[model samples]
Target: MTSRAIADIRGAENLDDLYRVFNENHLTAGWHKKRSSLWPEPRTSFQPLNWRYAEAAEAMDRAGAWMSTEDAERRNLLMFNPVDDNDYDTVRTLVCAYQMIKPGEYARTHRHTANAMRLILDAEDGVFTVVNGIKLPMRAGDVLLTPNWHWHSHYNEGAANAYWIDVLDVPLVHRLEPMFCENLPGGHQEVTSVPDPEACPFVFGLERMRAELEQAPARADGTRRHRLDIDAHIPTVAVTYIDMPAGGRMAEPRTTASRILAVLSGAGAAQVGERRFEWTRGDVFCVPSWHAFEVQSASPALLLEVSDEPTLSKLGFFIRDPAQPK
Candidate 1:
């Protein structure tokens, strides 16, 4: 199409109009966000955070180490919503503080059963996330996942905090059982990703083991039971990350404890049954207990996930099936 025609298409008035012109495969929820200022009101419901996350983050940031409590009331938060928090009848969810740090700062390494994630918000040159000895490069909006139990740490090697969101399965796990933790035992585990001056073993330099696990899932029920993938070290849940390029779709997995997803950047659409929700950079979403879904992304997306892992770790049941497949 000509530039004029393309421009006109980009300026479509509504989703129907946009879809009519570009088709569902090309339509992005974030497309006309600028021109289409507002959209149908979103459902407002319970939203609360896992108190432990807030406490631990603050405590760590306070003494330049780590926090240890879960009471996250109002203090320095910019604009949060009880409706935006992770509020559930069974699982607890919270989007703790979004801290912006200065240069030359390093957060200590730790592990636990509750899964954790760091969504890079902003940063300059030299920001790095060290997970299991791999010091991966960090860029604004680039997401790095630390599968539960992995010894992970981060440093502002650049000149800023390299902001990120901490989404953990804390509340769900703690309620199910005691959350276990340890300080990597020997400080920060050293990574061997230097010599090449371009390799990222700790980031995405796998050859066999990881592939084997994914190929033949660690469990028969499509979910790993009380089996620890990383030897008998840190007890953590099975973790996954979705780097939805400009536009991508992911088939929801089968799980009982339900699941939660957070928008990392760009824009996207989430199909929960017949209803759809448009999301932005900081928008968060919770997939109901066993609600089959197909995540549609408009721009590059970085969404974090969490579930009742500890319960399953205790040899309890945590399985689910499509209520009524689509």
Candidate 2:
């Protein structure tokens, strides 16, 4: 056996010596493929960031390996819900999206700040978002908010890999220089909400929302969400859209943060404070910080909204005196 092994080892420098052949004589003299280089070589080109889905999928494969790791097995913080902890200073405010994947199931822990929210570009029946004492069901076109400094998390209780776009104020706060963070020292924060869809004041089913749209004339006039202030809307806070009928006017809301209105499937006018906007489907408009505006749906129209909800509660910032028109 020894003689045979010696015969096989003839002219062989051990494994390391053989390995050095590939290491030292790599494709250095060959064509330099800048495209595959870890660091940019002589030739580099720029591509739109949105055009990286394939590369992202490959990265996700490696990340999945880490997620299925033993470390993840013991600790369940991997899937930090977007509303519960999506804020990380550099993201969110720039209006970016991210993912939180976990191997096991269920991420149930909550603290204030680093909150999470989701826009369901795609959703699964088993994927549900539990936020601030309420479990709001998920669906496409649903604009959800995981309020600031609030406890929240998500669960993919379905068979397939559920996913959604996480939305938060991380970018805004990161720019502001205050990146607050904390963990539930004992455990998750108290479950202020249950998984009841009705628990949430505003319910948006495309058909239902369509039916509920109040008709305002189509002359030079307009329409709005409601004449009522948020406080008056109460526990059943209805986040609504306003349409401009005949004239150019709006019934504004009681608000503190600049409203973000994304026009969905319509052509219209949106005026905040004093500025007016000509908008269309896929167009985005904003109300300046702490100002109220009226919207005139140029034609028939629709929109999406996010607001200072529970965040206003902790700070005691949102309210209106019913005695006065807010």
Candidate 3:
């Protein structure tokens, strides 16, 4: 339209005139079709994170004293990504947090549509999670899964507090709009089997997993690789272990799935795009989708990695950039 025509539309004297002009242009005020382009270009945000153990532990101690399991249900501090404006999420599709259960405390029995997992950071034999009817002991460095809609509860029988990283696919479920949760009639679920520390296959199995990976064939560059434990029921998420030997480095790889990695042992430096992150034991960091990243160590280093690869693959949205620069 000409400048005069635009001016006339903008200077419409009455609502009827504006409505007539809008109708002539085939437009309505209901919703703008071009809003998507005018809004944020990328729906997802990516921010690198490094949570220190000392600070996290101190915060957990304070939270444990401030809240009771019965009052709060579970004492957890969500790891909010810096790039997120207000969402209490670690990544776009995942919610990662640290949870603390003090001795003599019990997390109420509950189940939800979102799948969940726990990577034990600090715990003793007496601290366990009862899923369905099986009691799975929570030990340091162990990964446990509480699949979707499985009744679960936590109890701490030890003298000290139990800590672990709690991860859930809540954001994804929320987007799908089918999230549902229910509390058990009783406060805690019944334990059908006796609490045994060795019942779960992946509990305290890090050493065995490492040894088995060592025996497997190595890459042409000689770095040991393995995709470790995965929840059979929740196939969309998985845990992997990688060992970087002294003076060895793994090439940066880029993929569609986001990855959250924890340093299980040793020290290393990670290159994520143009940024470099130095990490040691107990340190946690993340690599968002499509960002090329590499891990190198001056000494043997073990890393525990978690990702939503299965879900991406199932939806046929998974892609890996083999040409990503090292």
Candidate 4:
């Protein structure tokens, strides 16, 4: 530990001497000396995303008008958060995109390892997603889950284009190095008996869910909350519906889970740190991990919140510090 020893360690000329110095200094081989050169804290390059519904819908329409399902595959415009030009991620572990299917068009059958969900931005009859032979109608303000490795495809029988926000844990799955996807043999998956979209328990009906929660006991926190229990099907991601009454304010909450909130109805403002972001119906925004955030509703507001809570909880890293000071 003397200055002379430290100088000798730094001046080592041979591998054996270096190894001896490393051992004496309580260091191991490989990258230990390089660790200090990296960033001192975790840096998430992703930024908050807010794409207006009209803009998104128009872009999707243009794409749908020119591109066929066979040519464009999914007809999706992937959302890129502000970050390094080389990085294409909506968030650290998530990817969000706007997808559309035109009238009489279909998104071909395919499945992947990453868990996916869709929040209907504009709903219409005849626009349904077939997952593993089950047809679930996509309705406005409703959330549909296409769990990991499930064969799914979308079809638009309605006269208009179906628009939705598609979210997946792509970054997480890709980083884990087990990403796999396969396309079905035909343009779409085989359809079983046409089932009622309302009957599917996996679809979270926004108004219905809100009404049910209204009848239930209110939370001590003053927010009516209802979470879709799809852990048995989609284990990585979870979606919840939160309703805040007019003039209501939710105290800032901190959690380890990263959340994306879509305003289904009414208007509200979200405060993160010292910045406040106002949101109205059809707007989407993100809340990064461990950032204290509070929601204030100008009127009765409903939000569809998507997060990787189940994944973090399963990995033993999920923490909810509601008492944390902002």
Query: 1-326 in candidate 4: lDDT tens per residue?
Result: 77977898789898889788778877778754645656533334455556566677888787766788879788887766776773456766788888888888888899999989998988688899999888888888888888899899999999888889988999888889899999988667787856665677568777778777787677666788888888887788878888888988877566777777778888978886555788888777777776667888999988878888888999997877746653
- In candidate 4 the C-alpha lDDT for residue 21 amounts to 77
Candidate 4 or 1, higher TM-score:
4
* Model 3: per-residue Cα lDDT over 239-260, one tens digit each: 7877788877887577888888
**Model 3 — which ten-residue stretch has the worst lDDT?**
34-43
Compared with the true structure, all predictions reach lDDT values of: 0.51, 0.46, 0.78, 0.80
Model 1, 1-326: lDDT tens per residue?
55865776788997677666654345546664437666442222433222222343454367433422113211123223344543323233323344444466565677766655555556788877677776777655444456667777666667544555554556556676867887765455686654332242223222222343355433221221121232232234343444555656766654544455555455777775455777766555656444556777777655555444544645765554545332
In candidate 2, stretches whose alpha carbon ends up further than 4 angstroms from where it belongs are 1-94, 98-104, 114-116, 185-195, 202-207, 213-326
| Superposed model 3: Cα runs more than 4 Å off | 1-44, 195-204, 229-231
Candidate 3 residue 120 Cα shift, in angstroms, is 1.1
As for candidate 3, its clashing pairs are none
lDDT of predicted model 4: 0.80
Off by over 4 Å in 1: 1-99, 108-115, 130-136, 140-153, 180-255, 271-276, 292-323
Cα RMSD to the true fold for all candidates: 20.5, 18.0, 5.5, 5.3
- Residue 72 lDDT, candidate 4, scale 0-100: 78
Ranking of models by lDDT: 4, 3, 1, 2
lDDT of 2 by residue, 1-326 (tens): 35644454464577644444434444232243335545321211211112122333345445666664233421211212134444322212334343434433555545444444454544567666666556666665554666566656666666654434443555555656677765555534455555445335433444444555554233334354531233422221224455444434555653443334545456766665555657665445544334456666656666655444444554675554233355
Residue-pair clashes per candidate, as listed? 13, 32, 0, 0
Better of 2 and 3 by lDDT: 3
**Model 1 accuracy (lDDT, Cα):** 0.51
Each model's TM-score?
A: 0.48, 0.43, 0.83, 0.84
